[model samples]
Target: MSESEQLMVVDSTGQPLYPATRKKIHQEGLWHETFHCFVINHEEGHVILQQRAKQKKDFPGLIDITAAGHLLAGETPRDGIRELEEEIGLVRQFEQLFPLGVFLEELILGDLKDRERVHLFLTDESMPLERYVLQTEEVSRLIALPFSEFARLTDETAETFQTADQEIIHRDQFVPHPSAYFRRVNEGIQAYRVQQT
Candidate 1:
């Protein structure tokens, strides 16, 4: 995504204020909108995670949600469904997405200040690893982690995960979202699994 791309800015209540360039919004600490989707496979008891491409402008090489992106100026939460297909090559209908909740998050690091109203969604879908045609500029690879193990790592209830490539030591590999945010995401996954059963 271009830093010059236009985005819808909003207030604390999520009421749209006006349009602003992505760069300006981040620079000014203006609240903007983002979409976060977590892909879960309850039957297999796993969740998908994507490794961001090293060339990404922000958070490069970090392991993040299954798919996520900023909502353009005229986009709604439903419109954000395209991100799943664009980022990870998962074409999904808007109805397949289950709304978790909207969360306001702020992060500041040196000159970068990000404030976003995150539209979170959960989807229970499983596909073969080869099915994902990753956009090399945005994503490097994808992995599946046991849902129970993910929850434990997020809560610091467990520390290490052995994957085919290498051993993952939670904090050393994953993106640094606040512990509560991870807890909320884990709970959302659990709740969705319960509803399915």
Candidate 2:
């Protein structure tokens, strides 16, 4: 199988085990490592989110992280920077990203055991939404919302997010990631926002 069709299965602690087809991993709920990056626009008090292409096999049309993907066999988390370029047409140095620590996210999407040891990261990029050259095959568009507005979704205080452009995004539109993952992501961006200021 191709890189997109296969994943590097890892133990719960994120140590590599072996290569497995993405199907098997999902079927078995096996632990796998994934790289997730969140783009922070501190100047605008916004966090960028990607709208997954409707063609996506999983979570079609859902709002997701800025850039993210599975770590194929023989790949390390650092190499995940490629996802940014491939998905959003943004070139970045690995060092430009701030580590938010590894997190475990578990979800059952109709028998798809989406268990991931997420290598989470945050990067401050104050670019305009129009600057992103989205790969329409993976991402339909980019949305930027203020940090507090996005936080309300995870904290379950709000049902929707209004983008900087004034577009309305319902909470259910986001991928059903575990609450802990969203919490950590929020905290990471908040701290980085302060530093950038």
Candidate 3:
């Protein structure tokens, strides 16, 4: 995302305040809106994860949600669907996304203070890992892990994941979200899966 891009700032109640540049929002600790999309392969019972590009401004080189990006000023949560294609080359229609829920996340990392209203979405879409045209500047690669294994790791009940090409250590390899956040996400995925059956 461009540093100069305008974003909507909101009060504690999520009411719009005023527009500010992306940089200003972070520097001022202003609450802003972002979107997170998680893609699940229901048939395979796995969730897709993306490795953020090392050059990213925040959380560089971390394993993150399937696709995520800031919602530009005046853009609705549904407008965020473009991020799937822009970040990972997955073209999805707004109607195809199942709304999971919105979450508020506040973090203070060094000089960056982030307060984000995250609009989460879930989708059961399967595609070959090799077929993903990753935006090299935003994402490095993609991986799929069994949802059960992912939940176990998040719950500290598992240690490592061994894939054909590499082994992933859970600790610093993934984003440092609160445990409850991961649990909620897992619950949402499971609920969607049950509804499908």
Candidate 4:
């Protein structure tokens, strides 16, 4: 995680532009690709979330996607499977994942302008929480929250998120992706559930 990432930069329309360092991409607001995977257990009504390590530069100590990483310069969305094992010690095959389509998000954190085409996927995991190994440099811990509750995460009236450990959190405790990002992910999860039944 200490090494600089070489990212494949692209235009807003997804046309290849050039390769650049992760720092350059953020500093210049250049569009880049990222891989996002959400692990869910539909029968148990839960989805896994990762708590970021306190030492992270961006969004430290926040709850975020179960497994995610920026795609390297020559990596495909399929290559993102490595993040599952790297971050959470869960090995997966590309064929075992569900496609959730690419999503676009633009954000500015102080002088950092982040633009990304997020390639999303979903995988089902129903294992006991303690069985998973976490890479402490990137993740603090993992939690499974009811999918029904997660759907209401961005609601104005939903003022708090109570974790499995009984720790209470506010909307700000989540990695600050736009509300649209959460909304679309919620819709995608719902649609996926419908297809399974």
Clashing pairs in 2: none
For model 3, how does the per-residue alpha-carbon lDDT over 6-42 read when each residue is reduced to its tens digit?
Answer: 9999976678989999999999899999999998888
Task: Score candidate 1 by TM-score against the native.
Answer: 0.93
Predicted candidate 2 versus true structure: per-residue lDDT over 1-197, tens digit per residue: 24247788899897888889988899899999989999988888899999999989889899999999988888898999999999998899999999999999898878788899999998888788899899999999999888888787677666777998999988899998877788899888878877766
Give the runs in model 1 whose Cα sits over 4 Å from its true position.
156-159, 163-166
Output the lDDT of residue 50, model 4.
95
Give RMSD (Å) of candidate 2 vs. truth: 1.5
lDDT values of the candidates? 0.85, 0.88, 0.84, 0.87
Worst 10 residues of 1 by lDDT: 162-171
Strongest candidate by TM-score: 2
What are the per-residue Cα lDDT tens digits for candidate 4 across 18-110? 899998888889999999999888877888899999999878998999999998998899999999999999999999888888899898989
TM-score for candidate 3: 0.93
RMSD of 3: 1.8
Give the better candidate number (3 or 4) by lDDT. 4
Full candidate order by TM-score, most accurate first = 2, 4, 1, 3
What lDDT score is found at residue 88 in candidate 3? 87
* TM-score of each model, in listed order: 0.93, 0.95, 0.93, 0.94
lDDT of 1 by residue, 101-121 (tens): 998888887788999899999
